[model samples]
Target chain A: MIRFDQVSKRYPGSDEALRNVSFEIAQGELAFVTGHSGAGKSTLLKLMAAIERPSAGTVLIGNQNVSKLRPRIVPYMRRKFGLVFQDHKLLYDRNCFENVALPLYINGVTGQEAAKRIRAALDKVGLLGKEKAMPITLSGGEQQRLAIARAVVSRPAILIADEPTGNLDETYAAEIMALFHAFRQVGVTVIIATHDAHGISNIPGKMLHLDHGRLTVS
Target chain B: MKHWINQHTLVWRLVLARTCRNKLATLLIWTVIGIALCLPALLYVIIDNLNQLAGEVKHEPQISIFMKLDADKTIVDTTKSRLEKHAGIGSLQFVSKDSAWKQMQDDALTDNIATNLKQNPLPDAFFIQPKDHAPTAIEQLQHELQNWEGIEHVLADADWAKRLYSILELGKKAVWVLSGLLGFALVTIIGNTIRLQILTQREEIEVSKLIGATDGFIRRPFLYAGALYGFGGSLVALALINGIITIFNLSVADLAELYGSSFILALPGWQISLGITACAVTLGWLGSYIAVNRSLARLNPH
Candidate 1:
């Protein structure tokens, strides 16, 4: 579903962030992107999402050369994936249900269909009873689950979780990884960026470890 | 298409929703915008009324063509005939020298006979009412009448009208300039308000962008908020102008009565509505767009 053919990324500071990076994830594969801080894990995901362009080589998502995709189609391309972040990027003004409903809402789902989807997503994260609770009121783990629910409500073809369990306890982090495994079981491609070896190392999945800025796939 | 409209609808919906949630800030912002918008709109209406009043006065005043005392009776009769036949004369009356003297005698009786004499000095006159009586109109007619044959002088009672009209014109122009400056102030006020809002939402914007929400999605509501600033401000201004007119209408009527005339206050018409609405929408759209785009650009979603 995603292919980075010898991709390289450079930021405006004249510093090379990603150099000669190459990777491929077959459809429905579950994988971990393991790296230390600033090891290009975030940069690779950003390139795949077309947030930042590669300085050299091409990045392909769904067989389309997103490297050459015009500016306008970028948003449409993004609608195909779910993204979870370590920060639980939920709107503070909105309740848990509303935050989870956002992706589907942007996709033009409404009325009975949207409510039903939001309930199911929230329910999957074990947050069914807390729909009306505001993000500011939720615990850290609950907020993380809400962000995950928001990501998966649209059932996007690919899931990119950037340290989705970064700030959680080992118990909560494993729970989050189990949810990602459930998605992979349903044939959705999943790639998680994290250094949580203590919590997620025992889980069965391909691990792509990065040192400096180059990936070592195993 | 319904799809496109829904996408765009988020901008407006979010604005209103946020306003409802955060009423105090929204209200304060709207009030600032209203004050700015109201000044210009009120001036525009007053200037319009001034123009109308000027038009009315232009069609009401007349001049008199006084014949020379040395001129013959035949010349006076011929002059009266020429004045009567002229296009400039809305109406003309041949006031014989005797009647002119009688009018002076009657006026003198009201005063004292001792001061009345002075040799029945009034001359035979042709009272020429021009087609238009505005200050400028009468002045033009005065020059044309002076060139007529057998007439020694042409004088129109238009000095005060000319001075008042010119003064009012200048006042109207001043109002226009003041309103324009106020319009700029309104834009700046709303732009600054939006800028602050952008600053407050910086973290939320970074989250949205990082999650793949496009810049347009994040900006939709802000644009709507800016539009509402202008729209709400305009409506407030409309109310303000109406209130001012209501409070001053009776006094204005009383002032006009001093001139032996009645005056009425008129409500604004469709023109004012169109002008205010257009000004509001333009300001709102531009202000929000600028604030949203700049802030969003600075936010690195990654």
Candidate 2:
């Protein structure tokens, strides 16, 4: 579960990124936070993962107060959810299988057990046959799929994707949205931040809209 | 225990993967580190061998006292008694002038010459072995003997030993200085290599951090790489030194044979080899640790 009550984030020598934002998404719920550029969607997700502490109020992931969590515990806390980026942040030097295995490797699961999980995750995203292919060699859609496989490889409780389909075409964006829908059906809480509200509107999910650092609608 | 093993095994795998990724760079770094470490270690081995060789050339401190031929038996007896009472004397052999003349007459070349001489030219001498072989002790004994009654001269044949000892002392100091400088060079070499490695893996580190990888997890591979550098360098240094020593021994073998010396060069003992390897590995690990921590601190993942 993710909860944000009166959460605000401000950068030094700049205006506030998020102002008095309040929202809660229960376990297994799928939601989208949409706004224009510089609308603090990325900051809101960062607060959930404890990447950036809220300037005021509380951001709670489960029962833990993420804003006040110890620095040493931040990494462990992040393991509860997977994060995806717009650029597909896959390590280009390694093959697709290695990239997907990153989370499992970090979690100390390896050999046959890790291989099984990695293969299963890749198979779900239709990248099972391209396991040996390098990221640079993959198409734009396949790369985004590979990133999705990596995010769910560890079976994280929550999935937070920041503009994951920004670089893909209309068809690939719909495919990514369908993948998120399928993950929610399996009890994985999913939250996505994107500026293209209309593209994802056709999918059935709660929508939280933001405008100029203020939460305008939920 | 199981968790510990799994963690270490994964780290080692990562290290191997990265090392294999850039074979040329790894080899270059290892070679540079090996050369830096080899200089000091080579000097140490050479100094140790030289000291051992010098040790084999044993020289005992002995003072030879010459007495005047006209000295009376009474004065000679008194001088002998005084020497016998002295604590510095280990043993003394008194060779009388008549016996010295007789011994010279026994020789084939001096027999007829000694028979034609009316008086014996040889003087009574005492071969005095000192209790202590220290240079200062022997010098003190020689000075004390020169002031004794009926003694004309006291000669201590230990100048060569003194010079050799002084040279060995200077060599020890020189090895220390050289070792210190080379040690600093090794640390720098390892540190710079680790820094470059950190730069190359910057994105990987950032991604790992975001994906819930701890600082320890991100640093594990770099630490292993550093230790491997030190470990590999020490091995290469050892091999290089042994090869050079073998060649040196081959060239010097004939010279030693000409001198009729059974001396052969000795390789460093196992303990010393292990010590050098351990020292190098520790330095490498420390350098990598410092570099990785500094870079990690500078990166703000958020």
Using TM-score as the measure, the top candidate is 2
Instruction: Name the weakest run of 10 consecutive residues (lDDT summed) in model 2 chain A.
Output: A197-206
Tell me the lDDT of model 1 at A184: 95
Q: What is the lDDT of residue B231 in candidate 1?
A: 87
Q: Indicate which candidate wins on lDDT.
A: 2
TM-score of each: 0.84, 0.88
Interface RMSD, Å, model 2: 1.6
* Docking quality (DockQ) for each candidate: 0.46, 0.68
B117-214: candidate 2 lDDT, tens digit per residue: 99999999999899998888898999989988899989987778668878888888987898788777777788889899889888899899988899
**lDDT digits (tens) for residues B87-163 of candidate 1:** 86798878988887666566744436625466756678887678876667778879887887778898886675677
State the displacement of the C-alpha of residue A206, model 1, in Å, after optimal TM-score superposition.
Answer: 2.3
Q: Provide the lowest-lDDT 10-residue window in model 2 chain B.
A: B54-63
Q: For candidate 2, lDDT tens digit of each residue in A1-218?
A: 88899988899999999999999999999899999989998988888887888889898899999877788888999999889876778999899999998999888887788899999999999999999999999999999899999999999999999998887789989998899999999999999998997788788887889998999998
Model 2 TM-score, 2 decimals:
0.88
Candidate-wise lDDT, in order: 0.80, 0.88
lDDT of 1 at A137: 91
- Scanning candidate 1 chain A in windows of ten residues, the lowest lDDT window is A104-113
